[model samples]
Target: MKNILVLCTGNSCRSQIAHGYINHFLKGRNVAVYSAGIETHGINPGAAAIMKEDGISIDHHTSNHVDEYSHINFDYIITVCDHANENCPYIPSKNALRLHHNFYDPSKLEGTEDEKHTAFLKAREEIKAYFKDFVSEYFRG
Candidate 1:
């Protein structure tokens, strides 16, 4: 099994979005998907809403700290934030792979509600596209 962890500063936005997409697309195909953060600062409503636009439900996902998976093994530890890439702990010798995928926090944009949601939606789509390409390159049969 290919165990992959999508990591971010908070397990709320980018990591959660990537988790939803990977779980939707890579089911029953030997790839396991999970996401975590340096700090579990609750789920981002914007991420949940944008993913809903694509028929994927990530609303129920709770924010999770990386310590949640300390007992498990990960084949890929992908950081969706600059902070996570720099501050990760306990990397396994055999299955450790680090990737830097910096994504803006759409929830942090200062704008009208619609404008903020637009940013979230745009980030969601780009993350999905890049993730699809990454999956095709690494995990496709």
Candidate 2:
């Protein structure tokens, strides 16, 4: 089995969404997906709500700091936000492939409920598309 880490600044929105999609796509497969942040900002309610709309539940996922998984070796370390990519800590996984994608941060969007929902939806779709392709190209047999 291969272990994958999705990272972000808060682990509340973008990373959590990616984690959900990766797990959903890789179900019954050999990949184990985890998400963490530079600093735990708690799970974003907007993130959970948006994912639930897509039939994926991330409500039970917890916000975690990168150090929480220091003992495990990761096959891939992916940064879902620029902040995370810039400030990521030194991971000890010698052979881990590091990848970065600057996904839109819905948590930073401020406005009416509809606007926020739209932002979340946009990010969710982007994450879903990216991870779907990732799983197909890299993990699918």
Candidate 3:
């Protein structure tokens, strides 16, 4: 099985959402998806809530620092935010393919609860579309 890592400035939102979709779409495939942050910022409630609405549960996931997975060999390392893509530390995965996508961080949205929900929904849909295509192109049998 191939191991994939989705990274972000904080493992709270975008990356977490990507992790959920990638894993969900690739289930029973030859891929294992994990996510982490340059610095752990705790799992964002908005991320979890939005994912649940899509019938995916990420409530069991915890915010993790990228360093925590330094020991594992990753087949792919994907950065879901610009900060993580630019400031990512060196990970010693021999043939790891690095990819980047700047997903909007819904946790950063401010305003009424409805506005925040809309932001999270938009971000979630974007993530779902991107990763769905990614899996079809790269991991489909």
Candidate 4:
């Protein structure tokens, strides 16, 4: 089984969304999906709420340090946030295919509650739509 890792700065929003999307859409497809952050902490509730709208739950996912999985081999290690993409240069897997799919930090949104939730929804939608397209076009049978 091939392992895929999606990364961001916090592992809370974008990367978590990515992990959920890939895991749900690609379930039983013989691939392992995971996510992490360069500096992980504080799993975001806004992200969880938005994902629930898509019928994807991320409540159990916690922020993860990139170093936690440094020793594992990955088929793909994609950085989905700009800060993480810029900072993540040395992923451990020599056989891994490195890619960048940058997404904005929805946690940085400044506005009302619904507005913040909307930001989370927008990011989640983008992650789902783009990843669904990507997997169907490239990884599906």
Candidate 5:
């Protein structure tokens, strides 16, 4: 089974959203999708709520430090933010492809509730599209 890890500054928003989509897209395809952060920040409720609106549940996912997954040999290591990508620790995995995309952090947006929701929705859509293409390109079995 192939393993994918989505990394972010905090495993709360963007990485979590990407994790949900990758798992949704690769169900039953012999792949394991995991997400972590350079620093452990609890899962963002707005992220989970936005995903739930699209029928994906990420409430069970925990805030994880990248070190927690250092033992696993990852097939792909995806960084969803610049911070995580720049500060990523050395992960010893044989030929693990490194991917990076800096998604907007909706959790950090300061605005009205509606504005926050809109930001989350936009981030979710972007993440979903990226991972859809990613799965198609890499795991098209």
Candidate 6:
């Protein structure tokens, strides 16, 4: 089994979005996807709502701290935001391949409901595209 961890400043948004997409894309494959943050900010409601729009459900996902998975050796450690990438703690996984991409935080936007929704929609699509390419390249069967 392959283990992958997604990291972010807060596991609430971008990391959670990536987690959902990785799981969706790798379903039935021998892969386990986990996401965490430098600080737990709880799962973002906007992230869940946006994922649901694409027929992916992340409602059951939770915000978690990076230390929680210290024991598990991850095959990939992915940082989804600049903050987490730069500030990421050292994971003891000897061979974990690290990947980083700074996705814009849609949750930080303060705007009218429609605008906020649009922001989330855009982020979701970008994340979705990224992970789709990632899965194809790394998990091709």
Instruction: Give the range where candidate 1 is weakest over 10 consecutive residues by summed lDDT.
Output: 90-99
| Worst 10-residue lDDT window, candidate 4 | 132-141
lDDT of 5 by residue, 74-135 (tens): 99999999999999999998999999999989998999999999999999999999999999
Model 2: per-residue lDDT, tens digit, 28-53?
A: 98878899999999999999999999
Cα-based lDDT at residue 5, candidate 2: 99
Model 6 scores a TM of 0.99
lDDT of each: 0.86, 0.94, 0.93, 0.85, 0.94, 0.95
Per-model TM against the reference: 0.93, 0.98, 0.97, 0.94, 0.98, 0.99
Q: Rank the candidates by TM-score, best first.
A: 6, 5, 2, 3, 4, 1
Q: Is candidate 1 or candidate 5 better by lDDT?
A: 5
In candidate 3, stretches whose alpha carbon ends up further than 4 angstroms from where it belongs are none
What lDDT does candidate 2 reach at residue 39? 96
Question: Clashes in model 3: which pairs?
Answer: none
lDDT of 2: 0.94
What C-alpha lDDT, on a 0 to 100 scale, does residue 134 get in candidate 5?
98
Please tell me which model should have the higher lDDT, number 3 or number 4: 3
lDDT of 1 at 71: 71
* Model 3 TM: 0.97
lDDT of 6 by residue, 1-141 (tens): 999999999899999999999999999999999999999999899999999988999999989999999999999999999999999999999789999999999999999999999999999999999999999999998
lDDT, residue 87, candidate 2: 94
Between the candidate structures 3 and 6, which one is better when assessed by lDDT?
Answer: 6
Which prediction has more favorable TM-score, 1 or 4?
4
Best by lDDT: 6
